[model samples]
Target: MDQGTSKGVSRTDSVDNGEGTVSKALQGSRKKKRDKVSAYERAKKVYEEIQEEKRKERRLRKQEREQRQIATEKYEKTKRKANKMFRKRSKKGQPNLGAQVEILLEKIQQKMK
Candidate 1:
């Protein structure tokens, strides 16, 4: 058989010629050559990664700040409600201490639960 142009032989098909396989040169030629990365490209990639990390951290911090703001707003709303309740006057024109203490106790119990 003619080794150079065998019938139905493909480049991927290895041929044994009693010495060894003859596809090493073909395989080497088929492999893609890798180009070395330049220092500027490496630095640019590192800088981009650092910037991405900073953006992620900033987003996390913004979310946390928003959460804290929401908690503060809720606390302020409850505080205003409590102050309004304490400022209620009776027929005697005095602060409703008894009702305020009852409301405070209920809030404490709810927090404990």
Candidate 2:
């Protein structure tokens, strides 16, 4: 209401909240601080959620590694068996068992890819 001043800066502390005290400005500043704290809290919660997801992903990776190790062991055992069987006797026109090992190796390579 004081159009008589330069740059519209009020010196009377009556620019807001009709009480004509500095408390209104203080309250506004406090509300801004509270909003900033709340925003920080929301960001912290999001960080915690991302950490939890990383933990879950690590657990799944460990489980998958164990499963792969077991499968590889089984495949190697089967390979050894076939090699031994093929070495001992050759039945006419039967497919080469070594070829099965090659196929299994190719499948393992494809899985890695």
Candidate 3:
């Protein structure tokens, strides 16, 4: 006799209508899904930031290591050149050659330390 009288609710006022019930349920579900997406986005952003920081640190350490290696090589080359010069000068006297060699070795050790 009355289609709007389901469970004694009325269709004249939309508050008592099935449309409001269905819309409310959909809004609640959408809110939950949106919260989940927001949480995931925040976590992803933090992970990316941490990775970038680590990359920067690695690059800096690599640069420092290269610099130290270059310095060590230069010191070694200078020590070898000094020894070669001392050997050539040794034709004059052996005592002078020993003293010069010792000085060159000490200089090299200082740089290495």
Candidate 4:
């Protein structure tokens, strides 16, 4: 085979050319020269972000629990007041059961509001 020309092969298509070897060597050096400190900083930043998200979630759950407790207390207070009023009215000899029920319902609705 002649150095200038080959039967079906071109000079650019040959991997044995020197350019390919030089480029591969440069790429290897570039990878080895990367900063280790930057990688550590990136990992630390990711960890902090995850911790912040967890804190937000915990705060939201606590607020929901507090709201539930408040609602329960309010409901219990309303129930006790209604029961006391019903007993007082009964002891007074109010004979109409339907009127007493209506009064109890109205009191409950007013307390809820």
Query: Could you give the C-alpha RMSD of every candidate to the true structure, in order shown?
Result: 7.0, 8.2, 8.5, 8.3
lDDT scores in order:
0.83, 0.76, 0.75, 0.74
Mind giving the per-residue lDDT tens digits that candidate 1 earns over 7-113?
A: 76665677555776667565455453335577899999999999999999999999999999999999999888888888888999988888799778979998999
Q: Per-residue CA lDDT of candidate 3, range 1-113, in tens? A: 77758877554433423445445456667679877757678999999999999999999999999999999999899788777766664566654667676777877898999
The local lDDT score (0 to 100) that residue 102 gets in candidate 1 is 74
**What lDDT tens digits, residue by residue, belong to model 4 across residues 1-113?**
67787876565544344455345456566668774458779899999999999999999999999999999999999688766655653566876576568777897888999
Candidate 2, superposed: residue stretches over 4 Å from native: 1-37, 89-113
Clashing pairs in 2: none
Indicate which candidate wins on TM-score. 1
lDDT of 2 by residue, 26-70 (tens): 868868987775777899999999999999999999999999999
Stretches of model 3 off by over 4 angstroms after superposition = 1-37, 89-113
TM-scores of the models, in the order given: 0.66, 0.45, 0.49, 0.50
Clashes by residue pair, model 3 = none
Identify the candidate with maximal lDDT. Answer: 1
Ranking by lDDT: 1, 2, 3, 4
Q: For candidate 4, what is the lDDT?
A: 0.74
TM-score, model 2 to reference: 0.45
**Model 2 local distance difference test score:** 0.76
Candidate 2: residue 80 lDDT (0-100) = 81
